[model samples]
Target: MIRVTAALSRARAGLMLALQAGLAAGLAWFVAHDLFGRPMPFFAPIAAVIALGSSVGQRLRRTTELVIGVAAGIGLGDGIILLIGAGPVQIGVIVLLAVLLATAAGGGAALIVQSASSAVLVATLTSTTGQPWTRFLDAIVGGGIALVVMTVLLPLNPLTVVRRAADPALRAFTGGLHDAARGLADADAGEVRAAVERLRAAEGTFAAFSAAIDAARENVAFAPARWRARGALAQYVDGAAQLTYALRNVRVLLRRAETALNDREPIPGVLPVSVRHLGDAVELLRQEWDRGVEPLAARERALRAVAESGRAYREGVGYSGGVVVAQTRTAVADLLRATGVEYAEATRRVRQAIGWTARPHKARRRSGRPGSMPS
Candidate 1:
């Protein structure tokens, strides 16, 4: 069922890409040929299609690279074909020259491939038209229109893109947090191990989240249409990274929990409540991420959860139990950072939320090191 859903999602995304590429190409061709009276102007649509690309993110950089590649191809192809005339040898030479020149010019894979392709067209077709600058003009027309269309015609919502990737990841993380809480409550060794495995499984979700944010960053980087949301989108990207860190901490906490459960150590009652509250907090965080609005009520709830757990800590249990609470505190603190809180403040807030009445936590609380967590 999951596979089917994933397949359908991919298909939908593919359709969107195809539609956008078709629109951009057709528009480029029309403007270059019909509007400008350029002879056929085939390169224009080709440039537009290449610039549009198929990926969901970073159209700006891709468009820029494509434009550079097309320009290089047209210039190299026109000059070489004009000097040497069209032939198999001239074709090969122009392509080689275009690729080498593009490479030396610091072009990436897309630029290199585009350069070679454009060189071939210029070498073979430009001579037929008897106008060297026509295709160069065609290339310019295609690239500019592609950028304009990509930027404004069907502009992507950065927040929507972030949510499409972040929601699943956040849910997975929330589930992991819930499982870890349940394991602590029941002191079930098997359940703790299972939760750990589930957390590991969530890595893919976070990876997709990271990729989506990167795309959003590119989309918002320069386009005036997307610039207004740039700050919010950037926050989402940073928040995703912080969530990754929180998940990592959750994994560590769960492993410690599993060991504690296996060893017949005490499990605090408040720990489960705290963990469950944090689970809810993650959901709220999702909401906050989606809206790009943060009063950080989610972080507040998470901090409160830590405070509740600290209540259990005040009474004292075993060393393992203390470590568990400490880990939970730190994990919640990590999550709070995702809410746009500073690390120092987040740590202070987590400690305050836990309502730890005791003195400062010593280095020997869990692992015997100075402020560094055990890996």
Candidate 2:
């Protein structure tokens, strides 16, 4: 029964993909044959399907490439097939030529596949049906219509798209910090190790968020309709980058924490509590990003958290404890830098607020690098 249910669920997951691909293919075909009067232009719908099937983050760039790939494939195949005549050898040559052309043009997997497939169609099929450059024309038609359908016909709010993508990564990062703090508070080496593992896994989220930022940038650049969002999107990208930097440092902190736990170091509970405060700052960062709310209070809260943790450290922690505390200070500095503060100024702000006095032996500003993301 469980197996049957799982299979059904998996199948259901494909429903949207099927719907999107089918509709795109149908519309592409209609535009190519009905509107453009391209006779039996089979490559048109294929281009549209490929465009719509690409991942959400960079659909604009991918669609443009797909259109170019289709044209490149058709032109190469048609020219080669006409010159050499249709045969298995001609088919191989056409494919090689298409691949070389697409690769030389800096096309990715989608373009390469489209080029190869389009070449195959031209070489194997009868020349009477797909005249010289007819498939290329069809590709133009399909690709243009696909862009129209994507951008104008069924437009999504650009900010909404970026926010949706960013939320998952942000949540993963915040949750990891929370769990790490909990483990630290409990002095559980095992729990710290687990938190570290989760933080490591969130690297994929980091990459995804980075991609989403680039996608949002591209979306805003190309779509005049989303021009008003440009400033907000820039701020969001900076914040997301800072968040990624903080998470990376958090991973290192968690590892050290695990080691400290194993060595039976007396990690002050105040330290973990401060980590929880940073987590709150992360939540507030999300609110600021999504709703354009003020983050000044959240920033103050985070600084206070770090300062309190610092005061506890000044009372005299051991070597490992001091290292962790320094890391926290750096992390705090990173968060501040993400708010568009200059590097030195951010350092000054964090140090002044946290009352971090430089020791003769230790290097200053080792908490974390400038967080250029969070604003």
Candidate 3:
């Protein structure tokens, strides 16, 4: 059943691709015939490739930028052509001017190269008789049509895109959190290193999604939904940070505990409890933040387990182990305090970031407007 479903999904995607291609071809043909009087040789194909290669969000941005670039290019190109007359020298001057203008406009180096190439193409192709302005307009119209078709017919929904991205990001963070917790319990250096690497990979994924969110926000069609998704992602990031800190401190405590256990010294009773509590806190934060499911009961249970474990460890320590026990106890106490503070802050920040009303002041500052405040 799963195989069949996957096959059907692939078929549907293929059909959509075909439909978009056909529509773009048709529109391109119509525009070329109507505007140029003679059909364009390969312009439509080029435009279609650009449209298909770009995401809906990026296509919109690039189109806006291209339009502005073309408009400036045409005005500058025409002025140079008129002043210098149609000669090899005039075309060379137009190319130089186009490159300079594109560079000055902060269009990036590649764009300046493209702009210069486009200017040379226009000058060469229309040197004999055709109007440079008209040709420029035709190219712009083709690109614009391609943009519209891509935006309207086969629109990539930002909400769907972000939601898809969020799943992998959440999984990565959750897996790293669990691995880090287990690594602390075992005092395994290799596992700890692996967990840190996984967290870093997850961080990279979050950064990419954040960039996508920013791009989507600039899109008039997807802005509101993208903003909402961005808010949700910010919550997940905060939760991940909390989980990370808790795991780090727990890992340190476990290392200390291992040293005491190996030295045949009395284990500090509070040490085990602190490690367990920190691990529980991380797990609870992951569940609550990622799934939006309240796990307060689970958290309470974990806290109790930690407390009991700490009591047991303390009771086992004898006078012979007094020095190690005291040292470990002090370290555990400090870690517990730090973890508790971090967990609380993470919870508060996650709430605000996710649009929950639990932290109004922070939410207000994040609202992107001046002091209107978030209810």
lDDT of 2 by residue, 95-200 (tens): 9989988899888998998888887887787573446777778777777766765665544456776787778877877788789889988888888788888889
Return the clash pairs for model 3, or none.
269-313, 269-314
The candidates, ranked best first by TM-score, are 2, 1, 3
The lDDT values for all models are 0.77, 0.73, 0.50
lDDT (10s digit) by residue, model 3, range 1-375: 999999998776456446666677667667767655744524444445444444443435565555445445555666677667777898888888898888777885445655676666656654444544555565566566666665555544444444445556546655664664465456454665676577666666665555455444444253342344554454433333333343344334444444444555554445444444444554454455455454464345344434443354326653323332223233223323323434444333333322344545766467443112221
- Indicate the TM-score of model 2: 0.81
Which of the two candidates, 1 or 3, achieves a greater lDDT against the reference? 1
Q: TM-score: which is higher, 1 or 2? A: 2
TM-score attained by model 3: 0.53
Clashing pairs for predicted structure model 1, backbone only: 307-353, 307-354
| TM agreement with the true structure for every prediction | 0.74, 0.81, 0.53
Distance from true location, Cα of 185 in model 3, Å: 2.3
* Per-structure clash totals for the candidates: 2, 7, 2
Using lDDT as the measure, name the better of candidate 2 and candidate 3: 2
Per residue, candidate 1 scores C-alpha lDDT tens digits across 1-375 of 999999998887667567777888889989988899876888899888777773456546666888878877997888787777789999999888888998898878888998899888777665644676678788888888877776777667777777888889989888988987887888788987898899899999899889888777777764567888877776687777788888987787778778877888777788778888888899888887677688377988888777776776556456666666767777787788888889888876765664433444563365452222421
- The alpha-carbon RMSD values of the candidates against the true structure, listed in the order shown, are 4.8, 5.2, 11.1
For residue 44, what is the lDDT in candidate 1? 90
